[model samples]
Target: MKAFGSIALAAAVTLGLGGVVLAKPLSRIISETGLSPEDFEVLSATSDSMLASGTPRAGKEREWINESTGSKGTIRVLEVRDNCASLQHFIRPAGVSQTRQIRTRRCRDANGNWILTP
Candidate 1:
């Protein structure tokens, strides 16, 4: 019985579908895209610029401008998968004259939206 329980746990983590995220079947599910680490950074920085509280829809794009400092940028959802999402954020800080790109991921919670996990 103990061994069976352990096996169940292992299976859940492996398939990712059972644990959270996508409603698709086991075969189509994945835990991570393996591109998350680098992508997630850009997403996080850009999302902060939006100053809104909600999950960005997959493929949704938004533009932002900082009125005070005149910094501007864009954020776009690259993709969304079972449990997590990939996003891109571009920013050109005021007075620096350079553009930056950041990519990041967000995991779903009980509320059914992508959010950065602790």
Candidate 2:
């Protein structure tokens, strides 16, 4: 009976460790936005600039600017599974308006390469 209990405990410990290994890191999800470090820096700068300029532009226009500039601003990592991740980017105008915009995308990290998933 003692041996059986010990074996069960060992099994449980192994399973627990496996679960942790299978879990994904939050940063990995953010990394999947197909954004390089430079891209992230540019996005942060653009967001700061927009906020400072107090521009009240349309959401579409803001998205266009971000996309054109290759910026993935304000991304939130929702989930990470295997090499794929789900993310969302929120954009808010810099003025005294309560407008908020959100965009969602799925991306994958293939062998350390990040790419947007179709």
- Show the colliding residue pairs in model 2: none
lDDT (Cα, tens digit) per residue for candidate 1, span 1-118: 3333223322333333233443443233212221122232333444644324555568788876656556666778787677666656565655656676555555767876445432
Model 1's number of clashes is: 9
Writing each residue's lDDT as its tens digit, candidate 2 over 1-118 gives 3333223322322233243334344344224333433444454444333333332233323332244444433544455566544444443323213423333323334445333332
Off by over 4 Å in 2: 1-41, 44-73
Cα TM-score per model: 0.49, 0.32
| Residue pairs in collision within model 1 | 21-83, 22-82, 39-103, 39-104, 40-103, 40-104, 40-105, 42-102, 42-103
Steric collisions counted per model: 9, 0
lDDT of 2 at 107: 36
* Alpha-carbon shift of residue 43 in model 2 (angstroms): 3.2
**For model 1, what is the alpha-carbon lDDT of residue 94?**
57
Span of ten consecutive residues with least summed lDDT in model 2: 55-64
- Cα displacement (angstroms), candidate 2, residue 20, comes to 37
RMSD of each: 13.6, 19.7
